[model samples]
Every structure is written in C-alpha cells, then in structure tokens.
Target: MKADVRLMVTADGSHTAINQTLDKTYHSVHGAFQESQRVYIELGLLAAFEKFPTEELCVFEMGFGTGLNALLTAREANSFQRKVIYTAIDANPMAVEDAKQLNFDDLLATDYLLKLHECPWNLPVEITPWFTLTKQESKLQDWQTNERFHLIYYDAFAPTAQPELWEPEIFTQLAHLLLPGGMLTTYCSKSYVQRNMRAAGLSVEKHPGPPHKRDILRALKMG
Candidate 1:
C-alpha cells in the first residue's frame, strides 16, 4: 500500500501526516504529540515497564507511520536507563523527506527523529545506548517473526479506514507474537475491537484516552 501523505500541523503545533489515500490522519487532530505521549508512552510503555521491570523490554509496533512512537520510546529508554529493543513494521512508511518536515525535533529539542527516519530498514540500528530500532518494510499480515515482544504499540489507522487490520484473525496473530503477560495498546476502544481481542485470548481493558478522544484499549496476554 503506497500512501500519499501530506504533512500538516496538528492542534498541538506538532506535525502529523494526512493520508490522502485512506482519508485518514496519522495522528489525532486534537494533538499529535499529546496523543502519542498519553496513549503509547504514559499508558502503554510505563505500564509495561512496571509489569516486567527486570526483563529486557522488547517492543513491536504495527504501524511505524511517522516514527513518533519510536521516537518517544527512545526518549523513555534514555530517561529510565533501560535497554529497549524496538521493532516496527509499516507497509507504507512516510518518505524520509516528508519525515524531515515534521516538527518533532523542534518540540523535543533533539535530533532523534531525524536519525529514526534515516536509519536503514531490515536491520537493527542503535539509536542510543539504551534504545535500538529495527524498522521493517512489511505489512502486519505478511510479517513472520520468531521474536516475542513484551509490549506492542498498535498504532494502525482507524478500523474504519482499514477494517481488515482490526479483524479477529489479526488480533490472534498479534496475541501469538506477545510473550506471557505481554500487553498490546491501541488508540481504539470500539466494542467489536475489544471483543476481537478477547476472542484472540487477550484480556482487554478500556483506559482514558488523550484529548478529544474518549477511550483507548490495552489488551494483555495472560498465561
């Protein structure tokens, strides 16, 4: 899927990609940085760390879109002084040129986002001493990996835009990728979405969402 995207300033003065092909915005219009920090970092990453404090944190992200989640995760790894191995896959990644147009460097006062975009795909690149990134050019359905992750950032497009991605089969595949007690977080909390996760053998929870959103989801794989 080749995505035709245009950079736009979100409500928080951060940059987001508007997918013209799918008629969807990569991040919330209310605030791109706010949503990523709240849903992925605060709720997802922090919770995962508390759940598996002594273990090496391995993360698998379904959609790498603008690399915002990875950027945030890298920063968290540095602050927590924990090593994080992050693997992210996207069928249609934003062009590096377009990624350069983002304002995350300005917001973060760091050049991490630039490194994330410039890193080679299909190989692990150490973004920091505490963080390593592996970007893959693949789709969720097509990806095959023996690695299991402690946390999953399901930052795919909305179900309305990509219904196939939210299917029960997809959740089942994701469930199998998680280690015991592993967690999957998404910015969606629809009834069917929760049901699908449950049917895939995950215990689901509804958490408070970011601004302009009501609720999000965090599903766990219980032994």
Candidate 2:
C-alpha cells in the first residue's frame, strides 16, 4: 500500500508525525515520536519492565512505524542492565532509505534510525549484547510465534482506518501470546476496543493519555 507521507508536529513539539497519503492510517495529527515515548516507552513499556525487573525482557510491537519505540526502549534497556528481545511486525515496512529521511536521530539521543536501518528484514539481528531486533515484513494476522512477550505495544493505526486489527479475535490472539501478568498498552481508549480486550480475556484499565489525548487503554493478563 502506497502512502503519502508528510511531516506534522505534535502538541508538545517533541516529535513529528508522518501522515499517510492514501488514508490516515499512518496519519498522526499528534507528534508520532512524542506520543510513542509518552504512551508506550515511558508509561507502558518502561513501567512494565521496571515492575518486573527481569534480566531479559521480550517485547512485541504492532506497528514498527519509524522505529521510535524500539529505539527508545533499546536505550532504556541498555541503561537498566537488561536484555531486550524486541520483535516488531509491520505489514508495510518502510524502506530503510525512507526511514533515514525521518528526524528520529535528531530527536532521540541514540543513533536509532541507523540501527533500524541496519536490522535485517525477516531475521533477528543483535544491536547490542542486550538488545536484539527482529523486523517481520508481514501482517500481524498472518504472523505466528511460540515466543511469549512480556509486554505488547499496540501501536497500530486508528480503529477506523484498520478495523480488522481492532477486533476481539486479534486481541484474543495477542492475549494468548502474552505470558501471565503480561501487559498491553495502546493510545486508543475507544469503548469498543476496551470491550474487545476484556472479551479476549484481558483485564483492561483506562489511564490518562499523553498531552494531546484524553485517555489511553492498558490491559494485563491475569494469573
């Protein structure tokens, strides 16, 4: 799917969003990087990682996008003395060339865009002794794995743009892939999405959103 990618600023002026050409699936009226950091990295992934305090943590990310979340998490993992097996699934993988054009390097302290470009497609590559990245050039529905994730970053497009992904069946599959007490976090706080999360056997909660958003959703697998 060809998308028209354009840059837009977020409310916080901390990150930029790349709007899709054909549809708003990749459209982020809010800053993409900033939102990812606030919702997923800081509040979601990092919080969960700290709570568990594991030597090695496994993470699953739905929309690789600009690889912002993955990079930020990698930096955190390195500082915390934890190993991260970060797996990301993107149906429409961005060309390494296109990703280089983004301002991720300028925004993030680490050279994450380079690392993202360096990661081989369809295979796992180690960025550091503690940080491994696997980029799957496939749709989430089509991908299957035996590895259970300790945390899931549901960064897919909006439900309106990608309705199928928001269904209960999808969440059910994700829930199954998670270890007990595993947590899932997304910027979406839609009622239907939360309801589906519960239907999929996850315990759902609503949390205050980042600067622009009103609320976000978080789900956890019950032991």
Candidate 3:
C-alpha cells in the first residue's frame, strides 16, 4: 500500500521488491525476475503442469505480484497447445499503467507484456483459443469459486510480514478448493507451513529450492 515500495532493478536488470524495512530487495540481488521465473514458474508450476494432461489445466495463484507467473504460464500454455484457465487473486491490485512502466517487457519480451495487459480483470479473457485468464482484485481469504483448480501457486508474502494469510484455516479452505490429486507449490519451507498443509488434508513434500533458497514446499491433495 505504501508508495515507498518501489521496484528496483537488480544487477542482472531484473525487477524486485525494494523492502523499505530491511533496505534490501525481497528476491535475489543478482537477477530478481530471472530467479522468480526459474523458481516459481519453471521448477514449480511448469514442472507440475508437465505431469498432468495438458488439455485443460486449472491454475490458481495467491499473490499476483507483477503478474510474472501469470504471464509466464500463458506463454507456456500457448507454446504447448495446452488449455489453461488461470484464476489469480491479489489484495492490492497494481495499476495497469504502472505495470506497463515496469521492466517486465524487458524480462518477458515485449509481445507477451502487451498480452498480459490485454488479459481482462474480474472476468475471463481469452489469451489464446485455449488459454483464458480470470483475475480477482480481492483477498484470497474472501475468494469463493466452485471451480476446482489442478495447481495452486501460493506466492504470499513472508509469514512475518503477513501472518494472518498463512494460518491453518486459510490452507484448509484452499484444500477444499483443490481437485483431488491437485498440487500446491510455495517458496516457503517453514515447518509451520508444512503443518498447515497437512492439517488441510494434503500430502506434503520438500524439494530443492531454486538458487539461493534452501528448500521449497509442494503439497498434493490425495483423495
């Protein structure tokens, strides 16, 4: 909410959160956006998507920061000829004009950046014949959708910054929204987060983290 949260270009010309509290960036100092693409998009979502049938993939993202994950997913779906119904929730929606000013176009290429803005808000907008995006400018806790998702990207802020969002009750609710055998991937590997996932009826696993991160959490809903 603070205007002080300006995007900083990292050493590798990637954008990242410049935390006012710590006076540091939230992601890697080397390549902020590049690290996110590798960790969340490639190792997390894309890897999970590859395991399942690609005809129709339902994806839900918790924090749609900069729409990086969403844009990457769209590009992948288009390339693979996979149909995707992407639902993303963000409490504080960024201004489209401001987003346009960011270096996302430099990172993801110009054409994809344009398509990202073209994807409608609060309604399903077709990106391709097979890929559609439905964005919600609301808190994840308040989101109520009957559509069961096959994959979830839990990219909330650190628990320390926003503890309420990481509570067990939230995870329980998310579990109910996932289809059986669906997977949830997160950058957090905290024990409390793992416990919450288990409480929500998911089988949890730990995987090697991307670059600087030590570990990451992946939970699967088993019927």
Candidate 4:
C-alpha cells in the first residue's frame, strides 16, 4: 500500500483501502465486495443489460479505486457472454502493488484482479473475450472522451468529503455522457444528491442499499 493508503478488512471479510489523506475508505466498511456487487453491478450494469439487451455495453466509471467494481463487472460479462467496453478514470490511481493487497482473488476466486491493476493505463486491454478495459489517469472534470455510455459507476467519495464532485453541474455533465435510457448508480442517496440529479434532467430513484447503508441512488436518462 502507499504511505497514505492502508488496507483494512470489511465486515464481509473482503479487503478495502483507507485513504488517510481523505479520511475515507474506498468502499463501505460494511463490505467492500458486497457493496460493489449491489451498487455497481446489480444496480448499474445489470440494469443496463436489461434495458439495452442486445447492444454491446459501454460503461464509464468515475473512480476506479481498487478495480473491485471492474473485476466484478468483468466476471459478469464473461458469465453472461456479453461484451463490455469499460472505461475508468481516476485523478490519482493506486499503484499496482497496492492493489495486490486487496484479496479480490480470494473473494472472487479469480486472478483477474491483478490483471486489472497491472494492465496498461489509457489504453484498452482485453482482460477476457467479453471484457475490455481502458483506464485513464485523469480527473472526471478534465477527462475528454467522445464515447457515450450505457451505464456509469459513480463511486466517488462522500458529498461531505468532496462536495464539489456532487454538485448539480457535475451531474449535468455526467447526464450528458449517458446514452438515452442509460443510467448511473452510486452509493450516495442524500436528498441534495437526488435533487441535483433531477436538476441535471435525470429521473432519480431510491433503492435499498447494502449493509450499513439505508439507500442508494439510481438516476436514468429518459429518452
């Protein structure tokens, strides 16, 4: 792990990293893998698959973090035999060595986690026949891409920790990146966050969250 980032075990016996500088963990303390599965996969990716059944799925993730979400998503793509083009951006990406500290292999029973971290950044790498990953080392505000997406994983820090990221203008920009009928899922469900989604012209819905969290948000771009 980096000097400021340390690994911790969550309630589900899965690994998560704590950013000492931000005073925040990359995932919920309740369960890292569980949270990713519920919020990003079940809510975000699976919902997109159902909504746009036959199309090759395109996904944009705001915070790549430990690549837990990508790992899970790749697993699903392989399982479902669906093609996924995943692009993820982070202002400060964790080192591959640091990512190795997370025991995703033990949790998912696959070595793809290490492959996800070690893959070259800023270029798409085929992790599996069904999954392609393009990692960008840039902030969401500065990221430039011509691609629109079917789903977005908005796993950013809490609003209290990074309030500017949760603003209406940011949500508006994110909304524009989504394809019609596309959606975004995040761990945050604060009233102001939902209001911001609505302000961004998305239809927001509240869903049951994973352990330790009461609710999560899913905002869709209505065609």
Local distance difference test scores for all models: 0.93, 0.79, 0.76, 0.92
Can you write out model 2's per-residue Cα lDDT over 170-209, one digit (the tens) per residue? 9999999999999999998999999999999999988888
Judge candidate 1 at residue 92 and give its lDDT.
92
**Stretches of model 1 off by over 4 angstroms after superposition:** none
Which segments of model 2 are wrong by more than 4 Å? 1-4, 14-22, 25-27
Instruction: Give the C-alpha lDDT of model 2.
Output: 0.79
Clashing pairs in 4: none
Roughly what TM-score does model 1 have, to 2 decimal places? Answer: 0.98
Alpha carbon lDDT at 36, candidate 3: 69
Model 2 has a clash total of 2
Output the better candidate (1/2) by TM-score: 1
Ranking according to lDDT, highest score first: 1, 4, 2, 3
- The alpha-carbon lDDT assigned to residue 68 of candidate 4 equals 94
Q: Return whichever of 1 and 2 wins on lDDT.
A: 1
Residue 198 CA displacement from its true place in model 2, Å = 0.2
Model 3 whole-model lDDT (C-alpha atoms): 0.76
Could you give candidate 4's per-residue lDDT for residues 26-133 as a string of tens digits?
999999989999999999988888988999999999989999999999999999999999999988788887987889888798779989989998889999999999
TM-score of each: 0.98, 0.92, 0.88, 0.97
Tens digits of lDDT, candidate 3, 38-118: 666776667667777644788998977667777778777777778888898877665566566667667666456556654
Per-residue CA lDDT of candidate 1, range 8-127, in tens?
A: 898999989999999999999899999999889988899998999998899999999999999999988998998999999999988888887899988987678989989999999999
